[model samples]
Target: MGKKKVSALVLATTMVLLSACNVNMGGGDTASKPADAASKPAGSSSSAPQKVVFWHAMGGSNTKVVDQMVSDFNASQNKIQVEAVYQGSYDDLLSKLKTSMGSSDGPSIVQMYEIGSRFMIDSKTITPMQNFIDSEKWDVSQLEPNIAGYYTFGGKLYSMPFNTSNPILYYNKDLFKAAGLDPAKPPKTYEELKAAADAITKTGKATGANFAIYGWFIEQFFANQGSDYVNNGNGRTSQATESLVNNEAGVKTLAWWKDLIDTKAANNLGRKTDDSKKAFSAGQVGMILESTASLKGLVDSAAGKFEVGTGFLPKPADAKEGGVVVGGASLWMMNNKPNEEQKAAWEFIKFLTSPKEQAYWHINTGYFPITKKAYDEDSVKDNLKKFPQFQTAIDQLHQTKLNTATQGAVMGVFPEARQIVEGAIEEVLNNKKSPKDALDAAAKEITTKIQQYNKTVK
Candidate 1:
């Protein structure tokens, strides 16, 4: 599916460059630590503690949680000293990581987005977390199965799921009541949603709805309708060779959304979720769909203004009922570090996944706790009581039927493919092209990229 075959001369030249870089990619600055130390973690008697460089993309409000977690881990340990560095957004962090691949200045552990799984495994720049888990005989049953299921492929966990979230219908309950609609009973299907939006817009105060034109939401819609984004069982069984986004479910999803815009039921607030969130919090829009990670922030923003409420993601009436996929990033151990350093990094990871730490993270941020035991913590119990709205997503995740569609698609070129899908969506929304045609075009482009990506890995 690649657009064109590369000439042998060019391919060989690129290989030669990679070969030169590969020779020096996994060494240098490993620090001085005794490899023979039998006892480590917090009780090592070794004079020089193993140094670990951890690069993460967590920013804004959640930054303090990560900082506190890392600080506590370091203070509690004598064998490992971890330096956690904030590395911009997920995309920026990935770009910088690729640039630092051949240098010794790279991190021992890094946080990467979920879509980058195939690329990370193909790059061979990191060690699979499964390897460490096997050696340590770690019991992983405490972790949430659905979340872990997304990260596991071919019986291997490439990374540790840190923060997890799912999309939900966030609505202004006060606006719903003002519009004479029942705030307690939100719409569950596409047709029902349009009716509610129309009702809300008829009121003079606010528009009916305004969801961002994000590709992640599109993918969720596909799952909600029991549709696959790619072939080969959503790329779980094998490397997907083509995209299947222009199918019946996809066309209907776009058509219904565009109809909302055309009917003046929903506002086209551009592609930024922030814009839509602003409108929702200001009572300018009645409803929006966003990840549960925005729950705490939205609750605070709408405080003393409009009441906030949540519902399950809406689907097409005729479509089979499905569930939402987990969103957020995971932690990976880099292979560039020494074995001792890698071992120390695992200790820090375990510390973060502990019931106490997971509870702290869940209460402070809107993301779900990775371990089930975190719910038993008094902090989580108290926080949930205060903001019961968070329970909507928890119930949604629990109700989801675990299947290929809900598990999400995988590919080495996912980030690029998302951009292409967004372009197609923009075309559909702006009337530049019909939904089918736009998606068909984007599918062709993404297919070529996927093929080319597979070629490089082979």
Candidate 2:
């Protein structure tokens, strides 16, 4: 819970990195300058398949699935051949992309994290997906509204949704049964969740409910209460100038979480998601809140040990049935390419997002398919039949309303803001500060960072 102090040299190095990349830590309008085009290889033939390069940050099992998807796309047609390249983590990819954009060596398409949307748009190194959709008159009606809502800004789809995920409550069914709670009925509200955790812990079936001290859950909890994460309509209508995490919703959320930990109904698992997941899978914890993307790992880890059940993220008892925000990365097309290359990249993107491909991706990686029609695909249907727990995330996405709060925040400094919020959560959880005090301090710090970033970009 203690804050780590950064040395002056480290801070200076970070500033240099940010400045070198021309990255504004706060949201801003798109740049007016055009992107530089990569030169075509000499003597390239028009009749051959146009090679399109794609840079992604997926690793481990996700890398395997993405590789298979790319291979399948290449084998499916001859008009375009995509070369999917692994580019390390999302932060690494973003850094490399900034360097590549400075020259004309960037990939035709890139997988950017949701938090990077505002930065990507402002960089003006990519074309909006809406342009392609409008030009082709493609019907995007099949895309999930909730999934699309996160990447859409100002009524425009900026990127193609892929590998979308939402947070869900994963509970140990056997623990619930042993605790005399209904294994079939999971908690739906903050109060209910705490009660169940308390009962389970008291019965000694498990230690308690546990979750990572992650900011994404805080964001979801705010959305469930229909509260904006930042000003200017969650940074959709205009640039966000400040954070609202110190508001009533935030205080209530952090207070409830603090109470749970204080009463020994939950454990402070720190910031590592895997730690909490391991605890849950090992039956050390009765319940956990994690991304839907973890469904496969949880199920596999709990095999022959216990049954894992899932439900939508818990909401406030008095709050309406507001929804959770979408998480995960999206596919973005780089601009300033030759017509053939651009078209080829678009074709590859279309193939990747198609129902069949998305179904395969969903089944293989446990990520939710962005397209609604993918749910009806035989593969997805079969997977759902095998693991009905995955259905909760899909249903949660459907129930979500396309509001600004649920659409998520769009600040260039969003990644930094998340870290700040997580630090505040640690402060409150460790009793170093009150929820309001901790959150207020974090909001102040984030506001200063946002102001400083906007000034540099301007």
Candidate 3:
């Protein structure tokens, strides 16, 4: 059989098995561990009604909201409980999962970034959520088809969506006013952005703009041009592993980035700090490309003195404005445990991603809502009037092509791939090499690593 057909068959079987097992998927008062499974005593049970442990990286004021959600879930339920744990950022969570999987103790549910999808699949340490959906005969219709595409492997959902976000253009109104440009208007195309950057730089208000991470920015750039960052977003669409980073689209995007740095309209800082955040916050940058997750931070840091506006990520002059990919993370269920623990984990997953849960998360954390129902919620609709930047994500999602590239980038060695690509961007900015040559070198190195990964995985 062909690779695609083989993968499809595998997915179909998993779904069939999942549907055969009858289970109550959503967490509620009646859903609990079987009597024999509830052998341990509860610790520090608060008023909130069964406490499943949830480890995530969403910290700061947003973490409080997660706790509140737990409290509310517990109060609403008499059987299953949720315990929220703030476990560092996405990278930290991956490392901790590695350690926890080796031992007996691990959180029932863990938060994972888009890249984690590969590791979770390789380890076979995560429960395919499609199983839970089928087992309980849950209404999958409530979730969008594309949302499942990001978390699925071999045709099954391995994780539930949570705290999802997308990239957008954040322009400084104060800079626009000083540049004699319309404060309400943001650059809608790459050509317009370059002109705006030059105009804004001439005003001496601040630098042109900053990108949080050059590689991620480049990925968005090509995505907007309808090019895949990595082989059709890691074969989620097809099994091809080709690299188009040296193509005309990629070369054009890379050259534009180099020009921005060469003209002194922008500065190249590694993704070490909130490059854009610090630049925009300190009034050193007039614009930035950043994740929608940073909306709250920008608003809070600006202190209402500066006007912050957001727009869809711009595309190349000739490209049909493709949409940006989603950021943030998802909830992954760990394997290597009893079915009862998995059952409990699935319950928490559903609870964390339900319409009510997603609405609360989007509003509280500034992450984009993963479900369409959240958009229908009056609370979310009302918030859009006050913080319209939040709606930029919705607009982008609608325009997005729903393909691998715009859905998300998939690379088994993504963390390493990013490091190499960033190094190339730096080389171009420093005049050490032309954008084409620099990316060519980086691509060669990355291709070697990709081959190594294929060998290892095979």
Best by lDDT: 1
lDDT of candidate 1 over 147-206, digit per residue (tens): 888888887777999888989999999989998999998899999999999999998788
> Can you rank all candidates by lDDT, best first?
1, 2, 3
For model 2, residues 43-109, the per-residue Cα lDDT tens digits are 1456687888999988877788889988998898776788989988776777687667645588888
Candidate 3 lDDT, 46-122, residue by residue in tens: 44333467888776787798888888877765667777888776656666666576355777778877755665565
Q: For each candidate, give its TM-score against the true structure.
A: 0.91, 0.91, 0.84
Candidate 3 stretches with Cα past 4 Å from truth are 1-51, 144-146, 237-242
Clashing pairs for model 2 are none
Worst 10 residues of 3 by lDDT: 1-10
- Backbone collision count in every prediction? 0, 0, 8
